[model samples]
Target chain A: MRATGDTWPHMAGAAAQPVRRATVATLPAVKMLRRALVALSLAGTIAGLLRMRGKGGVPPQEGGWREVGVPPQ
Target chain B: MTTPIVGLAGCGVTGSRVLHHLAAHQVRVAVYDPSPALARNTRVVRLESAADLMACDLVVLCGPAPHAPLTEMLVADATPVVSVGDDLDDMQALLALQPLAERHGVAAVVGAGMAPGLSGLLARYLAAQLHTLDELHVAVHGTAGPQCARQHHAALGDAALGWHDGEWIQPPGGSGRDLVWFPEPIGAHDCYRAALPDPLLLQRGFPTAQRISARVSATRRDRLTARLPMLTPPHAAGDLGSVRVEARGAGPHGERVSVIAGVAGPTAELAAVVCAATVGQLLRHPVAPGVHALGDEALAGLDLLHHATQLGVRVQEFTGVARATSW
Candidate 1:
């Protein structure tokens, strides 16, 4: 897919460089942190799903914009 | 829930990302581009002519500037349309699309991505939270490695137009400097006034705003390249983009009020998410038949804040802060 150009200035003629894949060995500390974050997120999602199992899911909004506080001072 | 037919006109980087977004939602999308290979995704129908795409419930023009011709044609067909990026930066050019949309009984949303789209919405939303609105300042910081040098030069070196005290003023790009603070990951940076569409779109939505300015800043190297043509664009910094919109007005208690909403992430992806959310609203037919800015009441008929939140775009609102002392 072509990137949207025309809307803003195009980045032309800049030197192209290949991106190196991040590896655990290259950045062990950062890799460990990312793994922990993913594990925590997955646990949270599973817990939330379990909690909502009997509640017929969260209730639908009574009014759309009302929940968002749309434009009206 | 039934999906509305969506037609995307361009397959550039931004358009490509937008296509992925719509597909993730399982919306039926047909894309038209000069090179059909651009829309070579297995999910969407790739059409060759405008004739096929015009019949869609909503059309997104991600094509190049000189949007007047195609945009006007869509309005004539009574098709609601939206454009991402800077094609409508010129007020006269965007205003030209309004009457056609009104006469055709279709809604046309201009500047519905990233800065112009999300920033405009934040401005109007903040105005709604105030008793009397006075001014608005929108600042965007994009930290890309040196690969975006040309974009930086165009953004910062070109002439800048800002709205001040009910008048539009042109200032040399990168001329006016202001130290602005943003959300974490993209802390305070020295921003300079640049000709961006957010302030203009905001002024249209909130005419009472006395001062409207849009400034853009980036990493120190990119900022330097934007100012000097001789310098080569620097290599990529860590990809982190942020935008902050500040609105100042009076609150119900007659105290000075400031409301700031900010989002930080990959700039192109953020624009696509915003564009997709806008398409989601248009599919629901909440927008009335006419032309409207993304933040205007007519367009806000759709739950923009809600749609944005659903896309995982973190939006933070700060209230009761004094503008002068805070930033």
Candidate 2:
């Protein structure tokens, strides 16, 4: 599945987890935790929108516009 | 008491919403999505594959119809798959996993999204109201913003097919009867015809409904409506919007009932709401073993929404907590 692309401004490249696309995952437990939380949080934030994400079975609803009360991604 | 952990196959819109709901109640989740960006918030893990099953009590398969193999792989010895996509093909795939699920003491609940999700609850709800329900008609109106639609437009193309009458009927996209919904912002809007009454699972779940049809009168292209389930070029692109389900039922003495429930947000946010409630119900209830559907006693319809409402999700229903009185 295609991960979130450079949709939102300033989101294209941030050096928190070194998002290596195309390459399969190779993170240890600690980094995986951080990556896992951030990624899942982002997923929660963009649930509805990503439901229809590109055809790659990626996040169907990715990026922006979260539910009113739910936390931001 | 903490709800048992849930395993999410897809962390897209619907999956995220399920996570959001669980998080509100301090529910921990173990998810396996290819997208690292999406699993950043919850108790997500980097699992090898669906066969791993993580350590979750209930497993929910979200997003559009993912590869059948991916779905089956997730149904390991002890995890039940609460599917968001349902069809004959889906049923067949799920049935293949029954032995595995049963072996692990897990039961699969198929078709657990908004249409199947809420509509299933309505079918059970209305069936309990009368000696017997005659018919159930569901009309959906979805309008997503342009930006959100641009990225994941293929979903609008999925045709919703369900049980109707004493037989199976594939009504054209715009072929179902027109309907009117009493929603929050969009008031009294017309609803187009869908494949059938509730999601595919309603056929078995609803007690005695003679016919059921699910329709959509989305603000999207009318021509693309019927082609929703077909292979063709889309008529338009990118526009996120809200979706509402209007259910019209006929009971004894011709008792007529119409109820509408839906989510309003940027497409992604709404998708999260759908997901949150789904996974939450899977863990909180007495999830039975074997192949289950959305309308099963586990995810108790509006009762799920009631849980969602307590956690601050936005839902609008005719009666129950979502009654117009609060609106």
Candidate 3:
């Protein structure tokens, strides 16, 4: 695989060992956080759907054509 | 110079839209379709057979795939061709016509539709903002027509081809889940790897890019039932769809940066606009006589996109805003 120098700028040479160790140590925490986010999003979606059921039903939004080009910065 | 007579094959959902766009532009078109339900359009001259399309200056194929035979016939006859085919195998077959197109001195553009077509063009547009572009990730949501819906269902079961580093990798279909954010109304969608032609076509254009992958947005139900036959017939025309392209590379300042951009609309209409824009580009400024993809350096991505915009396709970019700290 081609090395992503821009992505992993600090992961090079002997000085990178400590940074690599730190990254490895946080890997599990990062995974856990990601899973938690997914679960939360799923829960929010279900809640929204249930709320919609209490009302009539989901309303259809008609898509309209928008002017082309990038929005002014 | 007189305007070229363009031939259109297939009058299906997407093809019909292409005809409408071409006619709106006042382009003379000859159509070849066997369907008896084809509505009479004064702008189009109906033809009896696909062979009759060969007489036109250019032929655009929006038909169902296995387009190889018709594409071959057209290119071999020195008639330039543009195809909106998104099937992986069919796109490969079309790309294989490079030699034949070169031999006959006719240009043929393959996969000139929504995902592969607009997606590749968006990638090229983003790459221009970077110093050394290395990664391209494309995600598509929704389908255009019944044929497109069927292709999307089947693609989830076929192996996906991706370019990594310097070689190609075949990953199992429906793998590598990603949460991609598209321009709104079509917000964030859960995407997964699929047998799409975007990677192959984009690689042909940005050959130096280190990694390229393509995905399609899917729900859990969609993924679970992908291997099984469709439980229900696809809709004649699906809801609005969108294509998101993310390009990552070293920015002008040598820092890691990613640019995300997309186009959202009815998929069929987007595809038609792309096809029409490509047709206009080919007619006005002809490329070399060979098979090419929209992302190829020879084609100006910005110009094509500008033309598409004029045809009612909106291009959106993700300009992330700073989060409020106390909120």
Best by lDDT: 3
Top candidate, metric TM-score: 3
DockQ of the candidate models in sequence: 0.02, 0.02, 0.06
Q: Which candidate leads the pack in DockQ?
A: 3
The DockQ ranking, best first, is 3, 2, 1
lDDT of the structure predicted as candidate 3: 0.85
Tens-digit per-residue lDDT, A18-55, candidate 1: 45676646478888999999999999999889877655
Rank by lDDT (best first): 3, 1, 2
Q: Which residue pairs in candidate 3 have backbone atoms (N, alpha carbon, C) closer than 3 angstroms, thus clashing? A: none
Which tens-of-lDDT digit does each residue in B1-327 have in candidate 3?
Answer: 888899999988899988888888888889998887665654458999989998999999988877888999999899999999999998898899999999999899888899889998889788988899999999999888898999999899889999999899999888998877677778768899999999999998998899999999988888898899887898887778999888888977898887778888888999989999999878888889899888888776337777887788788877653121221
What is the TM-score of candidate 1?
0.73
**TM-score for chain B in model 2:** 0.71
Query: Which residue segments of model 3 deviate by more than 4 Å?
Result: A1-73, B39-43, B321-327
- Global lDDT of each model? 0.72, 0.53, 0.85
Across A1-73, the per-residue lDDT of candidate 2 in tens digits comes to 4345445435545634576677666569878898989999898879856665634442222122223331221
lDDT per residue (tens digit) for residues B1-327 in model 2: 555777777766556666666667777677777766654654455455766554667676664454356555655545556676533344556656656767767666665554555556545544555555566665544422232232123333444465656877665455444534434554445455543325456666664666766665555454454344434343232123445544455556676655445555444444455556656655556565576665655445336555545544465555532122111
